[model samples]
Every structure is written in structure tokens, then in C-alpha cells.
Target: MHAGGIGAPTIARTLNEEGIPNPTSYAKLTGYSWHNRPSSSLWSAGCIYSILHNETYLGTLCQGRQLTPEGQFHSKKNIPKDQWVRTVGHHPAIIDDELLRRELKARKEAGAHNLHEQKKNFPPGIFGKEVRCASCGKILTKGKTLRKTGCERTLFCPTRKKSPSHCKGAFISEKHLESAILHELKNLADRYSDDRVQIGICQDAQSADLIQEKNRLKTAVELIEKEITAYEQRSRDLYLKRATDGMSIDDFNSALSRIRNDVDKLRLKSKRASSELLHLNESIAAESIRMETVLKAADFNHLDKTKVSMLIESVYVHKRDPKSGTQAIDITWKF
Candidate 1:
């Protein structure tokens, strides 16, 4: 095959016709564990073109050029070039400088043409990293589903498409997802308009339960303090008795030792109760602040990037039950 070809598809077709194995196929045959689904093992124009444009094949290579979000397993995206780590002579070169230049020029032209074509029908993936599968916990990807009427944009679990056993979460229509969110937001807005109603709806029951626990601990600490005071008084009385010769030295010391041990126990109990109360109060305060943030932003009718960031933390999309034809979704608010 010619190194400089007509285009990606033509080159791919030629490679396929010549019985060359695709990347995934070759990897499998050589005992490499590639993560992609078996069905995607076929050679495609996009995959072939991506390989041809990769600069790693030219010996010198840059690594850590992309990063995933901290604490998240998936959702990888490219970082700025300045942030990338560069290395020279990382591997043996497969293509020379002159060949690399020609390939880069052709790739640039092809990319521009493809971008123009894509802009005509592509829908913006507004919820890019926010939507996730509940079962497999992977980020949902956007795609277009063609129908008799036109193309409908949807989000699906990428893992499920590759293998059903991995994730069987149903595809969600972007239109439906947006509509549901809007309706829920509108409902929140209506409820939030009234202070009493807002409190009733947004108030977390866990906060109330924590307050009860806090009160119990406070009561326990007070009781322990009283017991400690009583113990100290008994020790003082014993000292007075010993000083006046009303008690023997051995008896006074023994009684004081018992009192001291009892007081120590009370003090330890008081400290534990105080610590628990403090922790409970901190939790309640944090939860209250989060709820307040949600209540403050309740007037939203439509969601934009700013609104989404402010109001929502994440959205979990569960698999749809075939019998019910309903998909379960959980929306965690930012608060």
C-alpha cells in the first residue's frame, strides 16, 4: 500500500481488501488485552486515520498529554500542550521526517473537511461528563440515532454497546433528559417561592436526627460533669477527715484513690461526649449550608453550563427495566 494515500476510507478499504488485520484484531492475535468491544475490532476510516496521524510512531514521543479528572476512574480529556511531558527517542521511528510532514499536512486537511461536515448535524454534548451509568459507573457518550423523521440525539453507556454483560443500561434521549430536568427544576422553583414550603421540601431529615444525637451527647456530658464534681467534693471531705485525725492515713488514702479513679472515668466519658457533639454539630452546619445553596438557586427554568455546575453534582442513569419501559435516574444536587 502507498504511504501517501487518497483518503482515510480509500486507504482503509485497500488495507481491508489486502487482508490486513485491524488494530484490535492484531492486538488479540498477539496476546494483547485491548479493552474495546469485539464488534469494534473491524477497521474503520476514523480508527485508521487516527493511527496515521499519531506522532508516537516517529520515535520521539510526548506522554501524560491527557488527564482524567481527580478521583474519577474514567472521563479522560486532553490537557494543554504545555502541561504535557515530552521525551525524545522514546521508541524506534517507523516514519521519517519527510513522510511525517506529508502525513501531517494531509491529516490537517482531512480533519478540517470532516469538522465542516460534522457541524451540519452534530448536537452539542452539553452534559458531557455529568451523565453516568449507575451500574458500571462509566461516563455516558453522545451519539445520533437516525429515524424516518430525522436524527435523534441520545446518550448511551459506551461499555454496554461493546458488551452487554459489562453494562446493560438503556440509551437515554437527550430531549427527554433535558425535559425531565426542566420540569423538576420548575417544580422546585414553585415550591421555593414560599419559605415554609421550601423548608419542607429541601430540609434534610438526617440533619434533624443529628441534632437529636447532639442533644443526647450534651446531656451525657453534663451528667458526667456533675458526677466529677461530686467525686472531687468527696476527696476534699476525706482530706479534711485525715487532717483532723478523724480517719486513719491508710483509710483516707484508700477512699481518695477510689474517688480519684471515679473522677478520671467521668472526665474521660465527658471528653468523648464533647467530641461526639462537636462532630455532630459540624456535620449539621455543613449540611445546612449545602441546603441553603440549593434553596437560593431554586428559580431556574432552564439549565446552562453555569446553572448545571451550580445546582447539580452528578446524574446517575440506571438500566431501564424491559417490562416497565421506565429508566430510573438519580440526580444529586450540588448542595
Candidate 2:
């Protein structure tokens, strides 16, 4: 094969059948563990790429650090192999570790792709949909730092932010936002778990009230219709009296007009009340479903993409600990 030729990803089923490693720790260390349903090609390919480029593959690198566009972007001139901190020959090899390290070095020098990069979905944030820079119409992105410091992701268009000069959208890290949301969730969970907690969410009480209101509205609508019917009858009687010469034309016309206005008012009120009642009923039903979700939410440890989309409004990742070195994701509830 030529040096620049693209390598096709091995089919997932074939990779598993041949006892190649995957993302699962057992698979990565042992070989072919996920039996009933193996990791799909997408996930397996990701794993293969990570393993190949991992400086740790040769036991030569641990936590290989590189600068990002969002971090102190590094240049090729300053980085070296020894300072990279290698721990060679620790694990069994599937590919040539030396080749991987070389490629890794080259790629790192080029400023693209990483384990963390894998976490971000390509094509960037939901910008054209969610928020815009108002100025440049370009999407704002996460912050830049002198070193590997955590910054929130911002939403602004590239043209606006980078600018031939239209918008330098104020950027914020999604990370910080995410952390706040996570803290809120954890706090809420703890509060619910407390044995001595006295507070009630009042959902049941609220539901009862909603039901009562709906009934009241129905009754009110009936009364309104009765009033409207009375007014309608009065209008007809006045018109008939004038036509039969029982009342003056002026008096008949005035009385009929007044009665018609009353009937119209009553009808409008009845319609509004009916709509409100319907909405109240719908709200109660929705709340019931929401409470059920809350009750069952404890079962989930990790939220998959689909679930997160349905249940969460947005996710924010923020505030990296310099010491601990782990990223946190904060998810906002849809509510």
C-alpha cells in the first residue's frame, strides 16, 4: 500500500470474530469480549484509532498531552520525545507501536484529532438552530487559554468571531454551564434521597386542583350558555313584538341590539372557558407523565445520545481540575 492511501475500517463483526481488541477494557486487554452484540463498526473503529495513535501503546507515553485551539496551542518547535514521558513495552501489540508514535507525533504537530476531540460530534454545535451571533452569523466556540485551562463553549458564527469584522461574539465555555447543571441534578438527587426530607412536590395536590378547576369550568360554561339562551330569546321576542306592532320600532331595535350584545359576550366567555378547561386537562396529563419519568430516572447511569436528546435541554462541559484531570459534563433538563 502507498503511504497516503486510505485504510478502510475493518468490519466490526469480522474484527470481533478474529479476536481483535475493542473499546471495552476486557476486549482491549484480553481480546473479543462483547459476545452477544459486539461494538459496532463506528465504535470499534474509534477504538482502533485510539489504540494506534496512543503514545501509551508502546508503554512510552502516559496521558499524552497536546495543546488545543481551546488551549495553549502548541507549535512543532517546542515539543520533544523525552519530555513526552514514555513507559515502553507494557502491553501486547496488535500494530507497530513505533509507527503509531511517529504518526501521533506528526498528527499532534498538525493540530487535529484527539481522544477528547472524539467526544465532540463533528460539524460543531447546534448553532443555526439554537443561537446565533446576531452580528457575524458565525458560530462562537469554546475559549482559548495560555495553557490547558477549561473554558466554556460559546455560540457565535466563525465569520463573526474570527471576523473580517462583523461579530466577535462573546464566548463562554459550555463546560461551566454543564457543571452547574450537573451540580443541580446531583443536589436534587441527594435532596430526594434524604430520609428526613419533609418537602413535597405538590404534584398530587396540584392535579386535584386542576381536576376541580376543569369541573368548575364545565359548570360555568353551562351557566354561560343558559344566560346566552335567555338573551337570545329576549332578542327574538323584541324583534317579533315590533313586527307584530306590540312595541315601537325604536324601542324594539334598541332592546334587540342590547340583548344581542349580551348573548355575544356570553358566547365568547363560554368559548374561552372551554379552551382553558381543555388546556388544564392537558397540563395535568403532561405533569403525570413527567412525574413518572422523575421516579424512574434513577435507573440510568449514563445517558445515551438518544436519551439525552429527548430528556435534556442542553449539555455543558466546564471547569477542568488541574490536579485530578477529568472532564465533567453538565446536562440541563428540558423543563
Candidate 3:
């Protein structure tokens, strides 16, 4: 369907109409009852999108796309694409490279068109990308609605339309949001004036130390990556010996398991070092501005784009309480 220029939504709808079993249903049919239940039994556009983007059909094996940090339970973060271990031609191709390339191009063009339409309809507000839905952590989209009084600007989560299971949704009036932000700014200014808080201003010496640490982390990551590659190679050689040298199944399994464990450890180490390196780079690139100075000069009577950009990192708005009719707003400071 993608190769024929059918959009993901249309393909998903067609599949649902045809009574085709979705991936989760098919997995269950194959006796894989351990998988989590899907939110819906029907095909979805997101599933189609994932299928279209997957390179496994092109005979490529991709691994390490997700990593669980050490000591963390039931939580994983996506590894950067450049850090993913990929082996091309690892299996017989199910889809040609040309088809994959065409599908990718079509998806990119569709995404660009959708972004343009969204911008044209929504038109970014003062908060723009800084306001997030606390439930889903998605950036709240700006919107406008006509009321008896006049037009009202609002920020709302867009994720509800696609996956309400993740976030029922959140909405906040622009005026109310601005008021809350101004109040917070005022409080910050008052606290600074009273000498109740001290802002850590990054200096030249601190930047130099960060850069040094970054270099050290980069070296550590490279070494860890080399160790992973060596272990992977050892596993392959073991497999080859087991097949051709008539090695005992138990011994082969034991050796392969140890090598896999070592490789997993190295990958985790590389992920942590790479994460630290990324943070160091961001710290070095960020402008070293004193939060106290910005707070002292801020007017706090209204929202100023310049001041907000410099002082605030993001604002997360939670769903309103049913009984109290109040919303919780959390702000992250850039300092």
C-alpha cells in the first residue's frame, strides 16, 4: 500500500476492513501469550508507520535501539540512531532497497506537508515548544476558539486523538497559563532579592572542566564500543565452531551466553558514557547567563518572550482536579 502511494491511515483502515489480525492478535495466535495486550484490537496508523520504517525487511538486523539503565526497573530509553548496532544483509530480503527508499521519501514528504498545515492553522504562541502535557510529556499545541466574549487562545495536548490510553488530554487557557508563569517569576525574583537562593553561574573554568570531562567520556565510549564488537565477533566464531566442529550443545550455549552477557554490559556502559558526553556538550554550548540577573531585571507583570526564553526551560501542566477545579503547573528553570 505504501509503495502504491496509499497513506498509512488509509492502509490501516483497509486492513481493519479486511478483518486482518493485528500484530498483537497474530502473536497470541502463535501461542505468545506473554506479550502485553494492545490498546486496540484493530490495525492502527502508528503500526503501519512502524512497519514502513523498519529496515528488517531489507535484510538488516538492528539491535540496541533501547537500553535500560543500570539499577532501573521497567524503564528504558531509546539509544541514538548512530549508536544502534546494525548488520546489513543478515537475512534474506523481503523488500527491495528501492521500495524502502521510496516509502521513506513519501513519509518524509507527508510529514513536511503536515507540519506546514499545522503551522498555518495553529500559528505558534508565546509558549510555543516550552509547554508540555504533564501526563504524556508531549508539547501542547496552540489553538484558538470563539466564545461569547471573544476569541480565546488555548494550549491542549494532541496525543489524545491518537492514544488516549497514554494521556486522556490536558487543556489550559493561555491567559491562565501566562498568569501562573508571571506569578512564578515574581516569586523567584522575591526569593533572590531576599538572598534565599543562590544561582550557580557557569564560568570559564567550569566550561573548561566540562570540556575535559566530555573528552574523557568520549574516550571511554570508544573503548566500550570496541569491547562490544570484540565480544560480538567471539560469539559469531563460537557459533561457527559449534556448527562445523561438532561442539557439545551445552558447552556452546554456556560460552555464547557468557559472551552475550559481556556484550550487553559493554553496550550499557557505552550508553551511559555517551549520555554523559551529550550532556557535557549541551552544557558547553549553552550561554552562561546568571539567573539572578535575569530574575532581577524581569518585569513579572506580563509574559516577555525574551525573558521567558532565557529563564525558563519548560512548563508542564497537569490535568485539572475534578473536585477542586485546579490545575498543577510545574516549571523547569534554565539556570
Candidate 4:
């Protein structure tokens, strides 16, 4: 339950990234204005199923469990949360203790936590990391506007209070910003049709042919092994000299421990590199193909929002680009 705990919007975003299929539940992305789903036991049951089976709330990684023959379990088992092995520090978890408890409470009372009254009211465009309030240095938030005037994206000072200080609550009209963004975005869309972007990535991928890539990886592994062997020999020589000369065991042991730790790290890195290389070599052609596909698509629609979302990390608006009036959109995507 760090900023926004696992919620309906989280479910939608996860599906979008993983290519899972689900019928729309909200009228818009990151919106609570429900799409007015057809009321039926079937819908209610699905909601119940989604709540019960979802793994996000538990902070546990999941893989579909499989069974084996000889009456033995395969690589999968639904172990308890306490026993599940976790990869520490891999990624931020969506859920924590408090949200998990509250979610169960809400589900027991209502059908799902979603039906519970929202705790934090926010503005719509403020849903993502996009809106910045020029005043508070905080991203503007989304919420329902008073007088039922539809969603308003706004900036506010939470330090003052939860209630909106509409007096100081300055907002960028989303329509106007989207208009400005689109005006610049059109060129990005035009860049979609540019072939050179695709060509550059394709050329890079092609430069490292699959067989050559595998060989290079193997060579790197061999070099790491050579370094490890050399280090071990050096440590051994130090130990023998110290033994023959009656050197201080404390100093000798300290040096030996440091050397051993280095060796251990080196071995681990070597193994990791080797494993990574094996996977990459296997998928070299496939990844190259995927890159080619993305390149072609990027060339086709350089500025599509969805495509832009994948490739671009940030777009810096520049005064020079605006002044020029030609190539006014100064843009950079991982291109």
C-alpha cells in the first residue's frame, strides 16, 4: 500500500503490458467512472474470482503450477506466503500489509474493494506522472469536479489539507495541453512514417549476427574463467609464501578472505553472464526480428501515443523548436 495500492487501474495496466485479454470495466483508463457493466450473477462471480485469485495483493511472484507423473509434483506448487521464495529487491511490490487487510474487509462487506467509497479523490490527467502543478512541485491529481462538471485534472498542496483549496487550485486545461501536445505530437506521428529510424536499429541488430554473438559471449566467459584461475593461483602463492616465512596468520587470513570474497563475486558474475549469454544467443534472431517489427511499426506511426509510451521516456519542450516554426517539435525517444 505504497502510493496507490493494487487496484482496478493496476489490473488494467498489468493486462496492457502483459498482453492479457479482459473486457473493459472502466469507461476510461485510470477512471472510477465505471462502464456500467451489465448486472448479472455472472459479472458478480467474475469480480469475486478476480479478487480471490489475484496475486498482486500478496506480494508473491507466480508461475502456473504443473503436475508430474509418478504421482510427483512438477515445478509448481501453491505454497503458503511464508514459504514462497522471493527474489529480493527485484521490483517494488504493489501491495503491503494494510491494503491486503482492508481489501479483504471491503470484499467481505461489499462485492469488491472497488465498490468501497474511494479514499483519495483526484483529478483525471493527474492519474499518471504527467501533470505537474507549477505551484506545489507535485504532480496534479484527478478527481470529480464539483457541480458534477465532469473530471478535472488539478494541482493541490496536500501539506495544507485533503480538501481542495480551489482558491489556489490552479489547473492546466487538459483540452488545451492535449491540443499543444498533439500539435507537437503530429510530427512524432509523421516520424512514424520515416524509414531511417527502423533502418538504424535494424543495422545495429544485423551487425551482431547470431553466430558471432554466441561466439563473442563464449569468449567473454572464457576470459572471466582465465581471470578467476589467475586470481586463485595468486592467492595460493601468497598463502605458500606466508606459510614458509611464518608470516602473521591474522594478516594472511585477512588477505585470503578478501581474495576469496572477490573470487566468489567473480564466479557469480561469470555464471550470471554465461546464463544471460546463453539465453540471448538462443533468442538473438527472435529479438532482432522483434526489433525489426517495432522499427517497421515505429516507422509507420512514429508519434502514436501507445508507441510513444513504449519508446519515449520523456519529451522536453524547447523554446527554440517553437521559434523555428519548422521542425518545431524537438523530440527524443529511445531512438
Task: Please name the candidate that would achieve the greatest TM-score relative to the true structure.
Answer: 1
Per-model TM-score versus the true fold: 0.60, 0.41, 0.39, 0.26
| Model 4 stretches astray by more than 4 angstroms | 1-213, 285-335
Model 4 — TM-score against the truth? 0.26
Q: Judging by lDDT against the true structure, name the best candidate.
A: 3
Kindly indicate the candidate among 1 and 4 with the higher TM-score.
1
Quote the positional error of residue 240 for candidate 1 in Å. Answer: 3.2
Off by over 4 Å in 3: 1-124, 195-291
| Whole-structure CA lDDT of model 4 | 0.51
Selected candidate, larger TM-score, 1 vs 3: 1
Displacement of the residue 89 alpha carbon in candidate 2, Å: 45
**Each candidate: RMSD to true structure?**
9.0, 20.1, 23.5, 21.1
Query: Model 3 — TM-score against the truth?
Result: 0.39
lDDT of 1 at 84: 74
Residues 133-246, candidate 3: write the lDDT tens digits: 998888997777777986678988766534455476889988899888778777756654444334544444555588689889999998998888888889889989999999
Clashes of each: 0, 24, 0, 12
lDDT (10s digit) by residue, model 4, range 58-85 = 5645533333455665544455665555
